[model samples]
Target: MRITNVAFAPGHAAFYFDDQAAIKAGAKQDGFMYRGQPDTLGFEAVRQGGEAVTILLQLENGLWAQGDCAAVQYSGAAGRDPLFTAEKFIPLLEQSLKPVLMGLDVATFRPNAMRFDQLDIAGAPLHTAVRYGVSQALLDASALASRRQKYEVICDEWGLPVNAHPLELFGQSGDDRYNAVDKMIMRGVAALPHGLINNIPQKLGRTGGKLSEYVTWLAQRIITQRSDVDYEPKLHIDVYGTIGNIFDNDVVKMADYLCDLEKRATPFELYIEGPGDAGSKDGQITLLGNLCVALKAKGSRVKIVADEWCNTLTDVVDFVDARCCDMVQIKTPDLGSIHNTVDAVLYCKKNGVEAYQGGTCNETDISARACLHAAFAARPDRVLVKPGMGFDEGMTIVANEMSRIMTTLKAKEAAHVDQPLQTV
Candidate 1:
């Protein structure tokens, strides 16, 4: 199918669900903004009002598809270039990308993507938002043209020979209460939370005296509060740079922190993200490698994930090669190219780095679902709940999508099983 025409407009997305947040990435008050206001940390503030880039594409035979480009408030802190703002995607779509995208077959989607990469470097490359939005809309159009789910398009493109098996994935919820956790469980998520790095005073505001005490309380709450706990859930924490700051950048203290974490976080699986964002890429890698080495020597099973300094596919490769972290969060939009994101996840699997395909809360539905499709194709260790401020919307979309795919596969299997034996 050919992409005939393209249109785009500005939209809005939430920074967080609740009022109280640690990092304070968005503005405190409402204001008139042509583009969204950037916060102290240079994150786009759409809390009161920030913009999202919503895209519409007209495909051949009068078919159409939509996509929204959402970037995080703290895009810079997340290792994303801050200039990739929400409104930044508009011109790139109209001026540069349109000519290249106008005519292509749905089946040639993968190869067409490579052409996009080649087109990108000639001029200022389309920002991740621009790339993600266009790619997503095309995926939608391709799926409509092919009569398959968007995730199926990705899976087929990846040449996954395996059946669509049901897999367990986590819920990205900020609810620290029993009721909220229960709700997440009922919604069909695999784990309690893909927790944000709210452990800092600016956000968490003294969750407890020490990190261990706070973790102990969280563990107790999960173990005691919910009676319907089906799986041995993991306790995931995004520490930002709080741990390193608290320990004064001392690896010994950092090692001690992990040691303490092993005690409270062991009974349940533990994942710690951004234990420190030590200055440069080298510093961050060193911090991660030191932590990993210390954890191994001390027999700590806690998974250290690289979040901040590892933005793109190249960064993922560097961190994996160094054995700096146990897991890498493939922040989807940062990679821009869907092909690169998929290849990064596959590379991680080959190199023994557990992959968590996660992204910011600053995304919208279209981009969020696209990331979910990638997660399904890659079969990563965990997937983030995204495309909305609150956990419910993203969680529901991802869970339902997975359920539908599995149901379809099961029905196909059942039909095959019941077929006549004489044919064999």
Candidate 2:
């Protein structure tokens, strides 16, 4: 089916955008707002309300398919696209993208996604957020035209088998690390508490003592409150490079710390994301590659994940090829088109690197659901529970959607199995 029309609705994303540069530069938090001038060009303050634009595509079948255009929480850093506010992008979407979307056939997903993903306006490609949301709309339209689930559309086009089971879900705790983590354990999250250890003074501690203590507490909490003896969840923490900072990027020191942290985790796998930022892609690869080699040499079981400086599909490939990280987080929005997310995940799997299909808290329900469909089909190692920082809300959205889709697919499979053979 073809897209009959396209419409745009400016709206709020589930979380706020933060000026990463300013925050790293020690912006003080005053309540929810950061009390400092913005360091990022598009940001008016250190932190501001995040915005999203809903792309609604009217299908020829008289149904509407929608997706939310959203940027990462820490935009304008790490070679990513600038902050995405609905007001700044609505006119461009109308003038440049609406016409393209209006007459496109949505019978398939990849070509349409690539068309918009690579579309140039004023000598530059459309913003990542635009491509992200628009591609999602096209995917939904394709699935609708085929009268199949979104995951089915992905599997069919990409030659991947639909996962009979749900991908592992990783939950984030935002700033409410302690309370929210308790909620995650109770809910049986496969990955627990992405402790947002962005701050050195408050969260990570000057010498990294704070984080070590937190890890010990996390392991103890899980042991005490777990539903069963086998309820061991991976302890994945994103430090935003603070660990690298405290140790002065000393690979040996970092390896020792990680090895010790693994012991503290005690029987659970540990993944540390963004251990260090080297300010540029090559530097980042070198830093992380050395750290990975160091950890492996020491026989450390802790896995290092690449996040910063790994924004696009090319970046993910570069990190994997360089053997810089054990896992590469395919941050969905940063990759622009959802097609890239699929490719990155598959590439990581092929290269013997784990893929974390991660997106930001600054997304909407539409984008989060679209991501889940991709995750189910691509079979990433783990997928982030997202669109908000609240542990419970995101958990509910991700878990319930997974359950609904899994049940539907399983019932269909059972029916086909029980059907009698017929002669043509």
Candidate 3:
């Protein structure tokens, strides 16, 4: 099927006040409160008077593809909040995507190689968030045209589970940071009930007192909260180069903290995300090796997960080949297509490494549905699906469209599977 039309819908909305308050209160009880506005950190608070951007693509024969891009607010020291403001990336979508994608047969697009040359040409200066938005649209369109769930298309083609959670945490507060953590947990529980929640904690530097203490405290909280659940929530912490300066010593301390948490009868699994600037390739490998040794010595089951350092499937393959980590986190935009993202997951599987899908903070329902399809299809070890939760008339419409797509695809799949072969 061909892409018939591409549309951009950009707008704003208010956050869910009650949800934000519940999150803030939970965090305060755990000693984490807003360093900025009282309820600003929760979805309801930040969405108040802010814009939410959505992009939709329609295919030939009236099929639909859509997603959202929204900015989330956070409280932290200056330059450290992990909010994703979509303005920097929307222009790429607003520009003529039709020229780049129209008339091209969706069946012939090589999802894996499409981004390789582009990424190489762009080098490290790539606009990750923008690339992610554009790629998500393409995946949605491709899935709709192919008559497959985005996740199924991704998994069957790429070899990984499409249902992994991509947890994002920003800031460096001690137990006092519990509000953000609580909100994240609640949201994960609410939005992605069937998926894994990969917790990516912001880093603590060499002078780590409260930061380290907080990591330990939060680990305990997760363990305690999940004790009764059938499957303990999956967690991954992002050090973001904050631990690079101290390396082994910090890893050891982190391991100790994790061991203590596990000792509390909390069976949750934990993974460590590599630092962003440590030359993610070599740095992540070395760090994972060191972490593995330390965890082995302490008998901890914590695994190492590659994130920022693993921008491509090749990078992930290299890391796996080197025995650097246990899991490879697939950042879809960085890979540039649903197919390639699936390929990355498959590459990880080939090497016996678990794969998890990561989400861009600026994703909309169209993108989330694409992600959901990818997750469902691949059935990855974990996934993170985030759609800006706001009250927008357009947002509601986008969601309805997504549900329709899912229903249509499932019906078509069932029909094909049940059909008897025609006599030649």
- Give the best candidate by lDDT: 2
The parts of candidate 3 lying over 4 Å away from their true place are 7-58, 62-64, 67-97, 107-131, 146-148, 155-231, 246-267, 275-280, 385-424
* RMSD after CA superposition, every candidate: 4.6, 2.5, 8.8
Range of the 10 consecutive residues with the lowest summed lDDT in candidate 2? 415-424
Off by over 4 Å in 2: 417-424
TM-score of each: 0.85, 0.97, 0.62
List model 2 lDDT by residue over 1-424, tens digit each.
8889899999999999999988888899999899979998889989999999999999889999998899999999999999999888999999988988887889999988888888999899999999999999999999888888898888888887666776799999999999998899888989989999998998998988999999999999999988799988999999999999999999999999989899999988999999998999999999999998999999998999999999999999999999988899999999999999999999999999999999999998889999999998888999999979997778888888899888887777768854422211
lDDT of 3 by residue, 1-424 (tens): 7777767666542331122323323322222222233443424332234444555667786876655444322221112122334454456555534355555455423452265225532234224333445566666666678765555555445544333233222111222246544544543331112111112232253444434465566656654554345534555555544444444436676566546534442344555565323443676677666766777898787676776556666776787788767877776655544556666766776678888776444344555566556555554566653443321322343334445655665565568775422211
- Candidate with better TM-score, 2 vs 3: 2
Error of 1 at 345 (Å): 1.4
Full ranking by lDDT = 2, 1, 3
Q: Mind giving the per-residue lDDT tens digits that candidate 1 earns over 156-241?
A: 78876434765566666552333556566555455555555444553333422366665676577666655566646766677776
